[model samples]
Target: MIEFATHRNKDPRLSFRVLDMTVKNEENLKRVFTDTELNPGFDKVFSFACLMWTSDHEQCLENIFKLLRSGGQTLVWFMGYNDLSIVYKEILEMKKWMAYLKDEPILKYAYHDSMDVKSDCYNLMKKIGFQDIISDCERKHFKDYVDIYDFKVHECMDPYVNKLPQHLQREYLDDVITVIDRHIKNDGLTFDLIILLASKP
Candidate 1:
């Protein structure tokens, strides 16, 4: 990544660092790039099934552009919000509750914004000067992708649940579990996963 960045800047003196953590603090970001040409920092970058949870997805995409070497590629796989096909009534109700929780200020950051830039990831990449953009959507039954869904919910949803009011936390957890169980039993859950590939120009 550093090599790619330096090459783009045409400066051998440039350097880069990859922090395996969320880039949320501008001060920390500034500190990390001191005395270096950090633009166009990578040859290839990838995010797997993770972009949907970000609050400022536009900013994130912009940063990714800044960090990519010219002609560098980016690959991202994320969930599509409107593509979930749920037939079970109980699961539908649970989905409503989940939506309500997502609106809460305390949990908003962890929630996925279905209509954010992520919804049109390919277009966003093109708008950001990316070329050769390719996007594909894959739909699958929840039972077939249960492992992935389980991991995502645990990683993204559990944290929010943990932060809820103590009195409500257990109840929420129970309800969510019940919904999952019912959906699995009835084969009522389905998901749409979108994959995007683009190259910075």
Candidate 2:
């Protein structure tokens, strides 16, 4: 966490303020930089969020570019595209079951997939002039590559559910309950995916 204030800034005496920053310095910073997401901000940008959503990554890189000086550095954490696609394809098949879960709040769209969540993130960071872009997809890094929350079905359970019209939400809640017993005959745990880093280039 290298912090330097120029002559015109609020803390203008050139005194470095490391207060409230993570790690001791950049070298120590490497100890904690792992799977995360980025959010754009005006000052120094540090993210510990997941990279499952590409739009968030794009916005985070844009924020890092805007917040830092020309030589300033940022470390972004996220998953690679390959690991996510496997889970995505399975989730893609869920598109066929809309009639059973469409009225369920979380699955209102039933077909909205924010594809290219990784390639798009990396591209956005590069366009923002991040040069040390290193993608480390060599590990099981992401925690939730595919959202499988239920009461009805998986995917789009967060904002999608909250975004639905209240009256239309309950229209399909219990409908899928009866269908779920027949849906998972094997009765087992399924694997999603895990991707590593996609940083600036």
Looking at model 2, report the run of 10 residues with the lowest lDDT sum: 105-114
**Residue pairs with backbone atoms closer than 3 Å in model 2 (clashes):** 36-49, 37-49, 133-200
Q: lDDT for model 1, on a 0 to 1 scale?
A: 0.58
Please give each candidate's TM-score.
0.59, 0.35
lDDT of 2 at 13: 29
Global lDDT of each model? Answer: 0.58, 0.38
Candidate 2 — what's its lDDT?
0.38
Candidate 1 Cα errors over 4 Å, as ranges: 1-28, 31-40, 82-119, 144-159, 165-171
Off by over 4 Å in 2: 1-43, 54-60, 79-124, 138-159, 166-201
Per-residue accuracy of model 1 over 1-201 as CA lDDT, tens digit each: 477776787756445566423565555455665435355367877877556556565566666666677888888776664223332234334554556455443323212244543346666677767788886766556655345555555434343465466677666666656655655545645556777888888
Alpha carbon lDDT of residue 22, candidate 2? 25
